[model samples]
Target: MALLVLVLSAIPRPAHAEIAAWMVFEVGSGEVIDQHEAFRRWYPASLTKLMTAYVAFSAIKQGRITLKSPVMVSAHAAAQPPSKMGLKAGSTLSLDAALKVMLVKSANDISVAVAETIGGSQAGFADVMNKTARELGMRDTHFVNPHGLPASNHYSSVHDMALLSRALLRDFPQYKRLYGYTGVQYGKRLLRSANREYLRRVRGANGLKTGYVCNSGYNVAVSATRGGRTMVAIVFGAASGLERAAKASALIEKGFDGGGVFKSHPKLDNLKRPGSVKGLPPDGYCRRNAKPKLEKLMADYAGSAPMRAANSGLPGVRTAFARESGRTRAAGIATSRADTTIPRTRDKKVDWGVVMDRLIGAQRRSDNLVRITLAIDPNAKRAVPLSAPSADDASKNVADAFGIVMPPRGKPDSRPATQPADTNTNAVPVIVTVPTRASDGTPTPRPAPR
Candidate 1:
C-alpha cells in the first residue's frame, strides 16, 4: 500500500500542469510500470516513420517486394520539408539504403519516396499503414502519411505508440540492428541519426525513435536492455528534445529498478484513450523562447540516476557521404544480404485472400440471384401465386419461390379431401317428391312447369 502510494505520488497526474503524457512498461511481462496521460492523443511527428518501417519490413517478409528493389523518388517525395535527406526527384536507391537514410536521418522526403515505391502512391501506403496498425493492436492510431509530418487526423497516443514499438522490436528481430544506429553513410556526405542523444547518453539504451513538430512538441519511444530485461519508455509533448530525453531516461531507470508501486495496471488494450480531441500544439511550450523554461525542467530531472550515469557527451557516429561526399562509417546496416536466398516465412494460419473471399461471398451470391431474377422473362406466366402462411402454418417450413425447403423432403399431406363435405339433400328431396306426383300428370304439367 505504501509503495503504491509512493508510485502514485511520484508519477504526475493528467491534470498536473502542462506536461505531456508518458508511460513505461516491461517488455516481456506486459506490466505497465507507470503512466501519466498515456492514452491522450498526441501528434507523432517523425515517430510515424516507425509504422512506415514496419509496413516495409512486412512487405519484404511477405515477398511482395525486396530490400534491393529500387525506390524512385518523385517530385512529391522531393518536395517534403527539411529533416529530409535532400533526395532529388527522379533519383532512385535500393529500398535497404532508403530505409537506412529515413531511419537515421528521419528524412521526410525519403519517407514519401519509400511509401510511393512500395504502395504505388502515398494514399495507398497510408491505407496499408492504418490496416497494419490495426493488425498490431494500435487502436488509438490513425495515420494520413508515411512520414510523421503533421496532418489533421494523423495522430497516435503513447499507449498506441508503445504498442507499435513493442511490435516492431518483437516481430522483426532480424531488423533489430536498425534501432541502434546514430546515422547512415551514402557516398561522401555523412548523414546523422536524429536520435543520437539517447543512443549516446543512456546506458543499455539502443533505440527506437524520436520526433518533433510544432504540434507534437518533442516525442520519443525508446527501448533499452539491462541484464536480460528490456523496457520501452514513451514521452510525449515535452518542451524540448532535451526534456524528452531526460524524462525518458528517468523513466527507463525507474523501470530497470522495478520501482513502480502498483503490481499491475490495465493492459494496453484496456487503457483509456482520447475521443476526438485535437493534438496539443507545440507553439506554446516548444517555441524558441520556451527553451529556458524547458531547460530548467530538464535541470530538475538531471539529478536522476539515469541522467547522472548517461554518456550524452559522447561524439555521434559519422558515416560516409551521400550524393557526392567521400564515404563515412555506418553502424548496424543490414547484415542479411538482398542477393542471398530469403526463405519464404509468411504466415500460413491466415490467408488474407481467403478471408476476403469469405467476407464478400454471401453478398456476391445474393447479387447473382438478383441478376438471374432480372434476366428472366418479365411477361412469363407465374408458376405459383404468393400468399401469406396461415396462423397455425406459420411455424411450419414453406418452400421458397425456387421450391427450396429447409429439408429436401417435405411432410406428406395425410388429411382426407372429403372429410368436411356433406350432401345437401333436404331441399332436393322435397322437389323430387313433387316431381313423382307430377309424373302422372307430367305430360300436361311438365310443359307449364318448363
Candidate 2:
C-alpha cells in the first residue's frame, strides 16, 4: 500500500513535520506578537546581508567607511556568483553605489567588496559581523561570510535576524532609506530587487531584505508601519519567494490587528538559543519533486490578497535561451537568425539574387528578423519598410510548410551554410527527395548528384 503524507518540513521525508520558523515583533512596545520555532538554527542565505549592512552602517557611523568612499572590486570580491553586479575585478564604485547594488540587487560580489573595504578583508569583516551581532543581542547568530552563500558552520534564527533588523533601524535610522527601494538603476539597465511584495504591494511596508538559496528556501526580515505603530516580521524556511513575502505580510497585518501574545519579550540578547543545533538542509523541501506539496501549502496558508499579489509572477523569473538560437547552434548552422529575402523596390518584384546579397550583408546576430528600408528609387524621399519573417516563429512544421525532410544526423551538408534560410520560411524553395522503391517493396537510395 502506498501511503501519501504531506509534511511542511523544511527538511526532507520520513520527517513528516513542520520545518518553518517565524517571529513578529512590535518595535515600539517590544512585544512578541507571534512566533513559531523561532529559536531553531537555519541557513540565513542572503538575509545574511542584513548583518553585513549593519556592520557597514556601524563603520559609516564611526568614520571607518563613508558613503562617498571608494569601493574597489577586488579579485576576491568579484568572484562571488549571481545574484551579483557582474563587476569585473579592479572595477570600482563609490560606497553609495556599492551599497545600492548590494541592497537593491542583493549582489553577492558587491557584498564581498563592502566587507573587504570596511573590515579590511572578508575574514576580518566577518569577525566584525559576529561582534556586532553580539552587541545587538543576536546571540544565536554566527557569521562565517559577509554574503550568505552556503557554509556548514554559518547560521542564524528568526529571532536573531529580527533582532539585527531592529538594531539597523534603531541605530542607523538615517540609512533606513536603503531598504525600501524598488530597484537600483545601473546605467540604462534597471536591476530590480526581490523585495517587491513589501515595496510595491504591501501597505505601509518599508525597510528590510529578502533572501534565498536551495539550502535556505526563502527568508525575509520585514518592517511596516500602520497608524503610527511599526512592526517587524521575520519568516524562514518558506518554500518559495512569494510564500515568504505573503507570510511576512500576513504577520504584519496580524500584528497591527493585535494578534499573537502581547507579553513583553526579552531583549534580543536575553532571548535563549537552542543548545545543540544543525541547519536544515533544503534539498528535500525545495526540489522539483516537492511541487505538489508546495502548491497545496500555497493554496492554504497563503490565501491572502497581498500574498496572492506576491505570487502573481510565480516561477518564470529567470533567463530563457531563444529557441532558434538553440536549434541553429545544434544544427551547426551559424548561431544567428539569417534571412536572404530582398525587399521589393519601385513596384518591381526585385531581383532575388541582388536582394539576397544585400539582406545577407545586413544580417546581425542580435536581430531576430532581416530589415531593409527600400528607397523605392535612389532619390525617393520616403523609404518602404520591409522585414523578414520573425525567427521567433521558427518552430513550425517544416515538412508541412516547406516540404523539406530534416537531414539525418551524420549526413553530408544539406545546403551552403552562408545562404541558409529560416526553415519556417514560406517564400523560399526547399527540395525534398522521395527515395525510389524497388517493385518488391524494398527501398532504393536515390542516385548521388553528379
Candidate 3:
C-alpha cells in the first residue's frame, strides 16, 4: 500500500486539480487581503497592454511624447492578428485616440504601432517594457512583445500584476479615465470593451484591464472603490470570461467586507514567496474534454449571494442611451430635425419614413425604443427618435422606456441602484444616424441638418 501510494503521489494530476491564481489587495493600506498561487508564472496575454500603457504614460511624463503625437500604422503593425484596429499601413491617429483604442479595444495592432512609435522599433519597446517591469519590482515578469501574443519569454504572475495595478493608480492618477471607458467611437465604428459589462455590474468598480488567450485562459486585473476605500483583485487561468469576472468580483467583495482585516495579512509589497514555477497550460481545463473539471472549478469559485445580486440585471439601458444622446450632441445634430439616418441594405437604401412609421407604431404598443430601433436597422448608430428632445430629456425618455430609474444629479449609487417602476409617458423622440459608405467602403457620418 505504501509503495502504491508513493507511485500515485509522484504522478501528475490534471490542471483542474490546481487552484487558479488570485489575489485581493487593499490599496489604501497596501495589505494583501488574500491570495492563492500568486507567484506562479502565467502567460500575460493582452495584460501585456497594461505595461505598454505604463511605458507610454512614463514617456509622456518625461516629455518624450505628447498625447497629440501622431502614431502612424506601419506594414508590420497592420499585419498583426485579430483583436486589432484594422488600420491601413499609412493610417495615423493621435496618441490619445490610439491609447483609447488599444486599451479598450485591446487592439494588438495598435499596441505594436504605439510600441514602434515610442521606442523606434518593436524590439526596442520590449526592452523598455522589461526595464520598467524591473524598476517596479515585478520579479517574475518578462516581456518579449508589446501585444502579449504567444511568446516563450512573455509571462507574469498575479502578484506582479497587482503590483503593476497599484503602480498605475499611484503614479498616473490623471489617466485613470482611460481604463473605465465602456466604448470608444473610432470614426464611424464604435468599439466596445468587454470590461464595460463588468464596470456596469460591479458596485464601485472603475478602471482596470482584462486579458485572454488559450495559453493564459481568461485573466483580469480589476479594481473597485467603496466609501473611500479601494480594492484590487487579480485572477488568472479561469476557464471562461464569466468565471474570470465572477472570481475577481468575489475576491474584491471579500476584501471590502473586512475578510482581510481581522486577520494579520501581509502587506502587498512585503509578501514573501518561493521561486516561480512554469505555468501549466490551461487547455485541459478550458477545452471540450474538461466539462466535469470545469464544472468543479466553477463550483469551487462560485461567488457569494451579494456578488450574484450585484451582477444580476439587464445592462444599464440608461447609461447606453445616455451615451447615444451624447454622441448625437457631439455630431451637432439638430433637435428639431424629424428625419433620422437609415442604413443601406446590400443593394437598396432603407426608406427612413417607412421605418419611422413602423417604429412609432411599435413604440405605441411596446414602449421599447431599443427594440423598435433594432427592428428598423440593428446596426444603426443612434437610437430611433420619436420626437426631438434635448439630450437630457431624450435620455430620460430612454430610461423610462427601459424601466430604469436614473439617480438624481450629483448622487451616485454605492451599489447598482434599485430601479423603480416607470411612470413617465411623455418620451421625446430622438434622431438616429447611420454611417454611409464611401466609394472605397470607408464609413462617413451623415451630415447634420442645416
Candidate 4:
C-alpha cells in the first residue's frame, strides 16, 4: 500500500457520515465560499511537498540552486520509504528531473535528495523550511523533513495550505503548470495522475495535492479556475476519496456561484492544535501553554493561517485544537484511489505535531492537507510519549514547553561524582521508536511528491 496516485472510475462524493472540509476563493483577494473542516488538523501527506518544490523552485529562480544542479543520493536518503525513482547510492540527478519526479510521483527519496543537495542535510534543509513557512505565513504548519512522512510534529491545516497554494500560483507562476498535470511519462513508465476524476468533475480543475494518515485521515488541497475566475478547495477528515472529491466539487461549484472566490466563515483555530511552541528558526518565539511543546512555537507564526480568514465558517477547523477532534476516524487508505469510509476514532486528546514530522520528511510538512492516502499504519494503540526513565521525562518535556527553563539538552556531565569510588558520567541513551516495516517486512522507498 504505497501512497502512489492511482486511476479512479468517477469523481468522489461527500461522506455519508460526519466529515469536514475547508475552501477559499480569490486567494489574495480574501474571498471564501464554502467550507466544512477547513481548520481541522489532518495529515498534509505529500501535498506538503508542494512547499518543498516551491522552495527548490524559488532557489532556482533566485539563482541560488539551478535546474541543472546535480543532487546526490545519500545512504540516509536512499533509505527513505517508497514511490521513488529508485536511484542507488552514488547516483546523481539534475534538479529538473528531481523536481519533476517529486511533483509527478510524490517521491520521498527524491525529496530528501533535493533537500540534502540544496540545503545540506535533512536538518539543515528544515531550517530553510521553517524560514519559508514563516515568510509564507503558514501559521498552523511546521516542517520536520523535506518529504512529508507523518511525523507527529509535522501537522497542518487547510487555511495555511490554501495560503501556500495562492503564493505558488502568484509568486511562482512560472511553475504554476506543474500542479495541473494529469500525468507524466518517465523511463517508459507512463505515470498517471490521481486527479483525473477531479479534473473531470470540476469545470476548471487544474492541479493540487492530496493526503491521508491513520490519524490525519483523508485530506486534500485543490485548485481550479472557471469563467475568468480561479479558486482553491481544501478538505480534511473526509471519509473517503469519493467524499473528498465530492466536497471539493461542491466547494468549487458553490464557490463559483458568486462569480469567483466568495466569502464564507473559515476555521479560525485550524493551526491551534493541542500544543505550544516558539516560532520556527531565524525568528523564534514561543506559543506554548499547559502541555506546551515545540509544535506550538513552530506553528505560532505559519503564514496563510485560518486566522487570516477568521470569518470562514467551517467545521473541524480551529486556530488551535487538540490532537483529535470530535469526529470519527476514517478508514486508512494506501493510495489516492482507495475507497472512502467513515472512521470511528476521533478523540481530541494528545498533540500530533511531532507525529506528523515523523511521517513526511521535513520539506513537505506544511498544513497542506494532502489528498494521497498512505499505508503508514497508525500506532494509535501504542501512541504514547517516549520519555527517559529516572527523571520524569513527561515533567522535563512539559517544563521545556514553558520556556528555556529546561533546554532540549542537559549537562551531559551531570552525575553523582562519588568521592569514595570512580563513577562514570556516561548517560542513558534516548529511546527512539523504530519505524514499522512494510507489510512484507521490506523497507518502502517512497517516490518524490506528485
Could you say which candidate leads in TM-score? 3
Q: Please write out the lDDT profile of model 4 over residues 75-99, one tens digit for every residue.
A: 4566677767666644666666677
All candidates' lDDT scores?
0.64, 0.63, 0.67, 0.55
Best model per lDDT? 3
Q: Mind giving the per-residue lDDT tens digits that candidate 2 earns over 57-131?
A: 777766665666666666556557789987665566777777777887799989987876677666667877888
The true-versus-predicted C-alpha distance at residue 331 of model 2, in Å, is 52
Supply candidate 2's per-residue lDDT for 238: 74
In lDDT terms, how accurate is model 1? 0.64
Q: Considering TM-score, where higher is better, how would the candidates rank from best to worst?
A: 3, 1, 2, 4
- Per-residue lDDT tens digits for candidate 1, residues 309-375, read 3223334532211111222223122222211111121543433222211111101111000000012
Clashing pairs in 3: 385-430, 386-429, 387-429
Give the worst 10-residue stretch by lDDT in candidate 3. 365-374
Error of 4 at 102 (Å): 1.2
Per-candidate TM vs. native?
0.62, 0.61, 0.63, 0.56
Better of 2 and 4 by lDDT: 2
Higher lDDT: candidate 2 or 3? 3
Scanning candidate 2 in windows of ten residues, the lowest lDDT window is 366-375
Give stretches of model 3 more than 4 Å off.
1-19, 275-450
lDDT of 3 by residue, 402-426 (tens): 3356666645545545866445788
Angstrom error at residue 51, model 4: 1.3
Question: lDDT of candidate 4 vs native?
Answer: 0.55
| For every candidate, C-alpha RMSD to the true structure in Å | 28.7, 26.7, 25.7, 18.7
Give the lowest summed-lDDT range of ten residues in model 1. 365-374
